[model samples]
Target: MAQGSSSPGDDAGNLDKTFREWQDDGSSEVATLGGVYGGANGVNHMVLNVRDMEKSHDFWTRVMRLEHCGTQGGPGQPRFLRFYRSHGHTHHDIALSPAKDPDSLPIPTGPLQTPGLNHFAWTYPDLETWKQQVRHVVDTGYPIQFRMEHGMSQSLYVRDPDGTVVEMMYEFPEERWNENIEAALEYRRVLDIDNDPDYFDPKPEDMPLFDENGLAEAS
Candidate 1:
């Protein structure tokens, strides 16, 4: 499509090295920072339309290290549904439901480029927990498709059984990015994750923030 108008899940493979800025399409509309109205509280859960519930259950638990709460319907039942949770927050963070017609769709072989759910991220409650999940993914030979140092947070992106992008990330202390969230959003550093021996550790120094004019400055 057009530069700066691409979705985050665009099929383009070289975004890691690309420097991007929002391109206005001549629309002057804007939304309130938080919201003029309260809006929905937050994304409580997501139910994915998956081809195989068992396979999806395996991958979701593998990447998220979530608790497989339970399953619903089976045997004489007409559908299969499974639920998973990360505790601390709510009863379930993700669930799986059978797709409308498994054979009608061509299974995606790469990152999703189509119009749909872009991606959903789950920020681990603690750093070690997040690293543990990353290590497990590497150890088990699950493909770690993308890695990014996003200033305030570092993330690893992996595809699930249905080729949906799921990001596992952990944020640094709020002090690191609260000062210049605008700069934080602009920061993008793609690192050689597996090659770097200490990739799981917090960056030695705080990430650089910038002034309103985009000049590098302290956090």
Candidate 2:
């Protein structure tokens, strides 16, 4: 299905302006700034630090239904465990390393409004099932951060046990995504910034705002 356009106040306008300005300058900086050379590969996986490897592993495996990919280091190497969705490939979708102390890492003890690595998103096949998954998580009493209509994707955000944010999304159809890509390029041209705001900006209400549970609310 066609992904919806971003809301009026969304950063798409700014991005299109920025992209246009960059192209006019004939500067190679935009490519480097945007990491365009790396191409658009979906997320490989995310690595997280946890207080206890065994406890984290058990929670992921039993509660989240992820398969244990195995651990690194037999005895002293720094115990790290990998886990993947039973149906996922790529070694793992998430990895956990034991933290010396949980308190050492800053967990979100406040509202979702606080910044930093809002969430990592996984793509789904369609929007209907995606919404169902959101409903399921809500019914199960899991916090929903927000739901968002990204103009390129429809997404849902939630938090994991350690306050790591997670997202599930369905990319817009190719044609629609391409249109947004073109618009984003235009935005980049008009604005002199090195990269698009959609990709950077640590604020939650930027283009994508999340609900109380931290889910990206649908625009």
Predicted structure with the largest TM-score when compared to the true one: 1
Tell me the number of clashing residue pairs for each predicted model. 0, 35
lDDT computed for candidate 2: 0.55
**TM-score for each model:** 0.74, 0.56
Clashes of 1: 0
For model 2, state the Cα shift of residue 31 in Å: 5.0
- TM-score, cand. 2: 0.56
The candidate 2 region of ten consecutive residues with least summed lDDT is 184-193
Question: What's the lDDT for candidate 1?
Answer: 0.69
- Write down the lDDT of every candidate, Cα atoms only: 0.69, 0.55
For candidate 2, what is the total of clashing residue pairs? Answer: 35
List the lowest-lDDT window of 10 residues for candidate 1. 30-39
